[model samples]
Every structure is written in C-alpha cells, then in structure tokens.
Target: MKAVIINTSTDSELVSADVVELSNEFNTFAQKTAESILAMGLTVAKAKRLSASDFETFCKLIRYESDSSAIRKLEQIGKRYDALHRHVDKLPSAWTTIYRLCTLDDSAIDASAASGALNPTIKGSDLIALCGAAKSSRGAKNAKSTTARAPADSAVPNGTDMVVRFTTTIDETQIVTLRRVCKLLREVDAEIALSNKLDAVLNQAVEMKEAA
Candidate 1:
C-alpha cells in the first residue's frame, strides 16, 4: 500500500482512495469489527502523520465526528497492541473496551490477559474499573509530593464536608451530549477529575448567585 502523505494541498485523491480501501476492508470483516477497527487505526495513524490539521482533514474526509476521541483511541490501540497479531482473537470486540485495555500498563495488560480478564466477553465498565484501579495504584505509589496534595486539599473549603452526592437519570441522547461536554472539559483541563469539574460549575453558580 502506498503511504498517503497529507499536505497543504490535502491530496484529496490519495486520501479518498485510502478511505475507500479501508472502509471496504472493514465491511468485509464486519463480524470481526475489532480487528477491522485496529486495521483502520493503523491506516489512520499513517495517513495523518503530517500534522494535527492533516488529521482533522482526514477525519472530515472519512465523515468521522470532528475531534473524535474514537480516532485517537483507535490510533493508540493500533500503536500499543500492534505486536499481538496472533492474539487479536482474544481481544474484546468493542473498540471502547480495547481502548480501556490500551490505557493499562504492559504489566497490567499481561496480568489481565493471563487471568482471562482481557477476553472478548469483558464489559467496557469492567475494563474501565480495571483501568481506574491500575491508575489509583500507580498514583498511590508515585504520590510523594506534599505540595501536590496540598493544592487539591486547599481547593475545597470543607474537604469531605463540602462533598455532595446527587443522582439523576439521562437518556441515551443526553448521555452522549454529557460525554461530549466532559470531553471538551478534559481538553480544557486534562488533569481535572469529573468531580472537580462539577465542583467548578457549582462554584461558578454560587458566585453568580452572590452577584445577583
């Protein structure tokens, strides 16, 4: 396959050809969507090598959502698990599940695979929980800076007492919108947790109330 080089000209012909070919191949393996997605990821990563603008163009050409996390996640999966060609069948069919698996370190991945936790039957939520556990464990091991801890503690006035829990149900469409908003928020502040995001919004609301 000839590599598609994205440039200022945009090379629409080459990009279009690659997209057609990849989409055709993906359709051929509809039953094995995960494998097809990985293949697409590899191709997308190669095609978008020039720049972020090139990537956005590529996404547009493929009719993908602008700034889709799916594109980034697929690229990461292709790069990280490229060596596991023979073990592809063992991987989960859902791209989101594979994305979660990709977030895990090699040791955690290996351990999960060895224990059957990384099988095709695994749920995305379970994989998310696994990633969270791994992240928390790593954070605990690496958190030696009191200064880092102090800022977070000082951010909230009453610590645990300031925390409040509320529950609400959202339909599928609303859930999708919420996820997109969360993604945008993360782009603005990558380190902010979802809880902190809510707190920031609430704090702003309180300030608005005081001004009124």
Candidate 2:
C-alpha cells in the first residue's frame, strides 16, 4: 500500500513524502469474507475471494439494460414509457448475488422451491426502491423479472433451481482468484475514497489559507 501527502504551502499539487499505500484493506476483505465463509465451516480455498471487476462482470452478466418492454414485464403492467430506466439502490440485489449464490444457475429461484443453506429470495429491487424513494414511485411497476441467467449458471429456462445453485461448480483456482480480485478491488476502492477525501480537505485548507 502507498500513501500521498499534499503540501498546501506550495504550488506543487501532491506532496508524496507523507503518502502511505494501504495494503491492509485487501486483508480486511479477506478477513470479512473469511469470517463469513469460515463461520459456515466451508472450505477457505483461494478461489472463494472476489475481485471488484469480477463482481462487476458477474453483475453485468446477470443485469439487463432496462427498456420499456422489460420494465413492463418486471412491473407486470402494460407497456408504459414512464417506467423505463429506473434505478435500484441496493448492495447485492436478490436477482443477482443472492439468486446466483443459492441457485448457481438452476431453476429454483423461489425459496419455496428449494431447501438450501442460503435462502436469498428477498427482492433486491424492492429494497433498492425503498432506499431513497417510495416503492410505488421508484421501483419498476411490475414484479421483478430474472433479466438474465444468474452469473455462473447457464440459461436453463427450466431447471430444478430458479437461477443458480450453491452447488455450482467453481474450481479451487477460480475461488482463490475470486478472493484475490475482490481483495484488490476493495483496496483500490478504499484508496480512491481516501484520496478523494484528502483532496477535499487540502482544497478546504487552501481556501482557508487564502482567506486568511
């Protein structure tokens, strides 16, 4: 990990003397996931980790660009242009992470349909809609639809699981790669966040100095 220090007194923009690169966030990522994965008594191979890109890629794989027709299908309503291109503010929507995690690309999306260790049937869209707006106004009007095959699973339009299954096959290498990718992504994200905050503070200090 590396860090940077900003010198407010000079025209020089970034003062690197005090900078520190943080490698521990990755460790934190490992720690958090380790706690969860290990608590379940599951194997803690390197493949269990996830990269941010991996997450994003998986998300992109499962997510569909919302159009009017798709929105209508989700909302279970007639085609209404007003329902197009809405936002869902959620961490891990049920339609993707939860759905994929449990079903691993199966036909059993509904909790009622399967008996597994993970029952993540909560509607991600429902939760996202509630974040900053009223449900009736924010969310797609129709019931949530499975936009694409959940992540790792194939498009089994009809299978035992609704989406993907926990039994989904991921080799040891993939799991380790996932863990490393996620850990690095988290570190990068945190560094970016910290950099932004530091920039803001430096700018504020500069402004105050000028005012003085």
The per-prediction tally of clashing pairs is 0, 37
Off by over 4 Å in 2: 1-167
Local accuracy of candidate 1 as per-residue lDDT tens digits, 32-54: 46677677666666655645655
Q: What digit string (tens of lDDT, one per residue) describes model 2 on residues 82-188?
A: 12111112113222232222212122122222333222334555434333233343245333444434655555555634554345688999999999999999999
Per-residue lDDT, model 1, residue 145, is: 40
TM-score for each prediction?
A: 0.50, 0.26
Candidate that scores best on TM-score? 1
User: What TM-score, to 2 decimals, does candidate 2 have?
Assistant: 0.26
Residue 76 error, candidate 1, Å: 2.2
Q: Which stretches of candidate 1 lie over 4 Å from their true place?
A: 1-32, 51-57, 83-86, 140-212
In order, the Cα lDDT scores of the candidates are 0.66, 0.35
